[model samples]
Target: MEIDKVKDPATVKLHSQVEMGSMELKSILGYDDQGLVAAPEKKSSDEAPLKVLYSSGSGSFNRKVMRNTVVHSIRTVVFSSRLNLLMPFGPLAILVQTLTGHHGWVFLLSLLGIIPLAERLGYATEQLACYTGPTVGGLLNATFGNATELIISIYALRNGMIRVVQQSLLGSILSNMLLVLGCAFFAGGLVFSKRPQVFNKPTAAVNSGLLLMAVMGLLLPALLHTTHTELHFGKSALALSRFTSCIMLVAYASYLFFQLKSQRSLYVPVDEGEEIHSDASDDDEEVPEISKWESIIWLTILTAWISILSEYLVNAIEGASVALNIPVAFISVILLPIVGNAAEHAGAVMFAMKDKLDITLGVAIGSSTQISMFGIPFCVMVGWIMGVPMDLNFQLFETATLFITVLVVAFMLQEGTSNYFKGIMLILCYIIVAASFFVHIDPTAIQDKPPETKE
Candidate 1:
């Protein structure tokens, strides 16, 4: 078919627009003829109908494209919107458990309910970041990224659940390093096929070093605690822990300065194929920013809900543990961490599936690093303030587990490339750690000891 014979109103208008020197319309239509003469006609008999329709600027083509876009957007929302829709379950779980006094039911519902609520917190913080500019946005994201774990730990610590808090911290580190990272790699591998997912190797190396340092910071205190059990009032242990917390907090602050000010590029992930050129004139159109007030509102609502759900979760722990036949160590180390970081885990996996390995690594590995550097120490300090004795004195097994997890993860991420097998290996390591915690029952350990023996 010829352009003149096409007999479409939009196409005719498009042609007229092109004649009137509309470069945008011409570029969109891919129109060219002998160095800008008459528009080209269909040159191939095998041309697809939709392509031809689109090229002809037909109304059907616009409708079809609009329909496809709308459908895709709806699908994305439906899949992701499930979490927002289930937000009420957090409060409902609290209410039901309060009314019926069924700890098991309350625990289950709250656990399930908090997943979406936590995810929404991330969404809210991210939205808030868009308005706060990079520096403040980064701060907001950093502060609230682990709010779930912080809130849960604070509540547990207040309730005299020190063991639960300790185990949950350990679980959070292991889960992020092994389970979350592995899932990201596996999903990315499947998405990209045989090609290895690439990321900023130098940045990963620096993060690995920081993570190792954090693990050591945690390990040394635990080692000291193991050696000196006869100290009067355990004051020696508390002093050392407080000192380490102060040092760790200082280190965390320096890290913030480094990431946000001194060496920012070392922290930001730049994809291999991304264009580096910038158009200064188009700054406003380039970035998608949101409203600060709206983000704050969401943050408030979600945080309040998370607080309610966490309360229910904390209250039901003892009963849920006995009813489920799961040890406190397992619940704290495995279940709590998983639930706390559910939003991050989902985000990492989603990014991996999209082949955005750099972002995936940041979400998974960077988060684990934050947990080690910030969340754990924040809790320790909070416990100190409340006169609750929280320390980094993890059990021997936990120390060993953390050591191995950090070491193995560091090795795997050294190359800044990932595959399905690597992901599987990480997952297997996490499962092994989890199984060990489940089977290894310590009767004398305060944290492992339950209030009531199961019948």
Candidate 2:
């Protein structure tokens, strides 16, 4: 029994293991030559507890996979960028909550708007990368791009946030022309030392449509300001907005029809240099059918989340505006919209760096298309359901600025290839618009129509 007790587990396992003599064992055990000794056993309190890092007991393996994946560095950059872009929306909800009491929850409903928008943009981005003409598919993407911003405007309209709606509209148009396009042009110029090319005939048609719509965006307000007749449409009457936008809508639709009909010959031929040559010997086959369904499911799920998040963002934005005392209009129009388009902005910058000129151009121009085609219509329809009409008209000062920006962008995009000089001109055009807005030109002066514009 004395020998067996001494031969038990090592006293200090971490240190070197040693074979001890009987004398040492006797000393440690406090036993000698066939004598019994009472020895104290180690207590649980004296030992270090075991540490466990991973356990499968809590939840799904998929979540664990995601958690492990997040540790990689590259995904970290993209994720951080996306999150930074999304932060403004959370504050937006607080702003809404501040503006209204519990009624603010209704605004949360607008998140449903995020899905169609993302789907449209993702599709457009992919299509444009292939040097494809701005097809119906591409146009659909353009529509979605403006989705969240448009939805927020509708929600604000439902709440009778006239000032917010108009301001956000102003913000979207001006930001695209100035901040969005300006940033794109400037960055592309600096990074690649390349220029913005005009898209001649077909691209020109699209530019013309854009410029016309922008002008209409301004004219709606000017016409309303002067006529003072609130145009209504039955229970769902066409407001002054719809009538003015109708002209623009007709013009764009016609332009689209003409371009698509002649697309093969007119738009820079799609298959020129972009055709990829794949080797027959390569083992990678066309993707399996499961991949398609997976993409669709992911797309649907992501869209749903975006809409939910957008609703949260709109409310937070309203709350933040009240808290900050900054013009909610400015925040909605400029800051918030930018947050929503952070993905496109990143896409634009990446394409510029790689010098993918046509896709870069499409990203810039297509963004505006998304805002005009998708954003405006969505706002109008949603606003109506809520019983508050969204007006697209502008005062003379704003109208004039929009008119000028239109001419500049159109002229720049008239031919297909681009370089930095044209990009500078575009930036310069944006600067004039910014200055005019900053100065808050009197409505009277702009209405007076300086002799030059009148002639």
lDDT of each: 0.73, 0.52
Q: lDDT: which candidate is best?
A: 1
Tell me the tens digit of each residue's lDDT in model 2 across 1-455. Answer: 77766755455442334435656876665665656533332222223231112343435656776676545422333243343354344445445556764423423423323323443335334433333333432343344445556666766676676655665665566666555565665666676463332333466456557657666665756665666555542222246566655665666667677656755456543332223424442223222212333334443544555555665666555544444433344455555655566445555555544444445545556666655654565566566667665656555555666566667777666665555566666667656655545445333322222322434
User: Per-residue lDDT of 47-105 in model 1, one digit per residue for the tens?
Assistant: 57767776787887799877886665434333567666776677778788768988888
Highest TM-score scorer = 1
Query: Could you list the CA RMSD of all candidates, in the order they appear?
Result: 12.0, 18.0
TM, every model: 0.75, 0.59
What is the alpha-carbon lDDT of model 1 when measured against the actual structure?
Answer: 0.73
